[model samples]
Target: MTELNDQALLRYSRHILLPEIDIEGQTRLLNARALIVGAGGLGSPVALYLASAGVGTLTVVDDDVVELTNLQRQIAHDSASLGHGKAESAARRMRAMNPDIRVVPLAERLEGARLAELVAAHDLVLDCSDNFATRHAVNRAAVVARVPLVSGAAVRFSGQLAVFDPRVETSPCYHCLFPEEGEATDGPCATFGVLSPLVGVIGSLQAVEAVKLLAGIGPSLGRLTLYDALSGDIRQMRVPRDPGCPVCGERR
Candidate 1:
């Protein structure tokens, strides 16, 4: 663990004041490594909050570049990064906000073996990807690595969050909720339009869950937590793992 100096203590004074997250917890956060699987709306705030909160290392993976349309919710990118890779732009912003953090930018989509390799190296994984394929792949890799996965999604006025931890028996994986590869829904956030602040809400919550997992403090919901920004309601449902499910289940 890295030694905490006066400046470090001052930087994290609020966190150190909390009984759940004292100097020890702060140190754990400073030593933790988190892998974020996207750099768009949800990923943007997730990465930003984690970096500001002193997460030791962050690796952002995304194949897309910034465009004028993304400015509505992708806070990490600004007018200056119009054509730059999302991961690079996010990394630069995070690093500028907190020089103490190590931001690794992967300017390519994460899939196949690359996903597994990246998941294995990080202590925790955040599924901020917009697609179900990448989300499922992240879940499988995290289950295989026995790491906690913090998943969040926001489109239109609704957002959902769930934490999948294969390390804990009975906890459901992402695939447990959506079994089959469903047809791509029309009007993904970009086309349908989303309330920008809604993404920040979900993303910040994801970051909180990741920090709690790393520090071993607070109870993170193992099931699904849904937030409806349109109606202002939050619902949580317990999702049990399927014994016969393919991803993390035993063979029949």
Candidate 2:
């Protein structure tokens, strides 16, 4: 895209005013494409803000339907969309919010080879899925494609954010922190329960990091940033690359 037009400069006045994200940065954001792996809690705010911020292309992938329980946090879908495919519902909302961007909905579970194919096409991927299995798959595809991956997870009152850019020689990956899949946990939002706004917090951060990564505005959360909503505390720690990790390690 060329330099922001006068209308665009007026539309994104706040963003353009920011020294970190001037007119040039907004143009970069307009040319980038991002793939979001899930359209649930974390995806809701992530998709919403990214669309509003002018991410040119956003592909939302999800196989689930909007259930009544999702109303607690998944803001992208409403009562009218109950039982509808989440990808479609979320895409509708995003497009309604910002008609300028292109939003694609993939109403199918991304698994096996499909995940790799979809991930390979996007400039970056966001892991908003709530399970280790999907997270691992997204991470593997990102590493294989050498695209930046912005991952965020939130449950109860806790949240985590990280960026795994295998393209960067020193960056660590998702598996580097949680080496093994471990026994599955019954901590889904329906089970253990999650704070409604907590997901928004983490997801919004993920969107900001994604935009920054695309616009070259600031440093990404290359390591891990942890948050405890209950205590209002935050911490950041470096994640070391694992030489033997299955995903991004020696297998490549």
Candidate 3:
């Protein structure tokens, strides 16, 4: 809300020292608000980095409670946090990491008008939910709200990261890449088993993209990045808007 104080400056001196993000970019980070759609896997790193980076307000939405099985990849929760709401648990870690910002924990599923409302209120949205249904709902809310969305998914040893910016006319929304009727291959980590750090890698990239978009530092739009942990490879491809499709299409 106000200019960075001496303590804040000293705290973020390393970031401020970056040629691309000096004082002006740091201020933007200090005033921005972001909505994280899930507080597990991908959301864990995204939430941590955003909080550590000093995003002014973060609203994390999730209805699931932490389970013993989730400890493998859900770094925000541990034995002490079992049965705690994922959003609240992540919020606790965020607050502990950085007390400078506000973290809102929404311990309910986001759907209908409520989803759109939350999307509209924040400057950006990150989709970290595992299911396609939740991804579709979040996509719809984000497209309607016209807020930029950073989405990531990890299963087994592979993961995908995408950044959709409604602010760009030619950018592809989530639906543009994968229509609602597209085949769904969602398998939770608990069922299929995922490498422990796969989420960390993808989630960290989500954090990087989120920070780039927020701080105006690097490229973060109109592309998809896929990573293969087994092969240790990364690939990127351009994703253009679907002119004839629904959701952010020209007809819409």
Candidate 4:
């Protein structure tokens, strides 16, 4: 582990002070590499919190560009970033927040071999995408790479969070919880109006799980957390791994 400099110690003093995440855990965070898929609503908070928490390297991927409509929930981009690539815009904000870390922005849609290679390179993957296709693709890559994935989604006042660690024998992968064959029609914020803070709630949870995993702390694996903004209720449902799952099962 790389030794923390005086400035880094001062910058992350609060985290280092915690018994759960003392100097050792903070050092782990400083050496961690995180991959964030999408830089929109959910990705914004995930990226910001990870960066501020001193995650050493962050690779943010997104092909979309910032538009006026995104300003409502995408906090990483501002008026000045209008018409710019979402990944780049979010990277800029992350960099601005913590120059001590490295931020890589990929302004392209990741798919196939390229996606798998990127997922293999990272210690952790955070799925903040809106569409089912992208989520499934990312989950497949993470499972194959044996990387822990922090998945989150928010739309129309509903939010969901889950952590899938392929390293754990009993932990369920995203495919085990929501099979690709049973995919629902994607309902993005653009279609059904989303509460602006809903993404923040779920995305923040993603960051928390990511940090815990990177710090060698126990994560909330094999369970799904659901947040209903309308009724103000939060709940968790245990998700079991399918022996017949195509993505992470023995059958595969």
- Model 1 weakest 10-residue run by lDDT: 179-188
Write one digit per residue (lDDT tens) for candidate 4, span 1-252. 687999999999999989999999999999999999999999999999999999999999999999999999999999999999999999999999999999999999999999999999999999999989999999999989999999999999899999999989998898888888884666788898899999989999999999999988999989999999999999999999998898999623
Model 2 weakest lDDT span, ten residues long: 178-187
lDDT of 2 by residue, 85-135 (tens): 999999999999888889999999898799999999999999999988788
Residue 170 Cα positional deviation in candidate 1, in Å, after optimal superposition = 2.0
Ranking by TM-score: 4, 3, 1, 2
Q: Which lDDT value does model 4 have at 251?
A: 28
Model 2 spans with C-alpha error above 4 angstroms:
181-186
lDDT of 1 by residue, 30-85 (tens): 99999999999999999999999999999999999999999999999999999999
Residue 205, model 3, lDDT = 91
Q: Best-fitting candidate, measured by TM-score? A: 4
Looking at model 4, residue 42 earns an lDDT score of 96
Candidate 4 global CA lDDT score: 0.94
Error of 1 at 56 (Å): 0.4
**Model 1: C-alpha RMSD to truth?**
1.8
TM-scores of the candidates in the order shown: 0.95, 0.94, 0.96, 0.98
lDDT, candidates in the order shown: 0.88, 0.88, 0.89, 0.94
Clashes of 3: 0
Whole-structure CA lDDT of model 2? 0.88
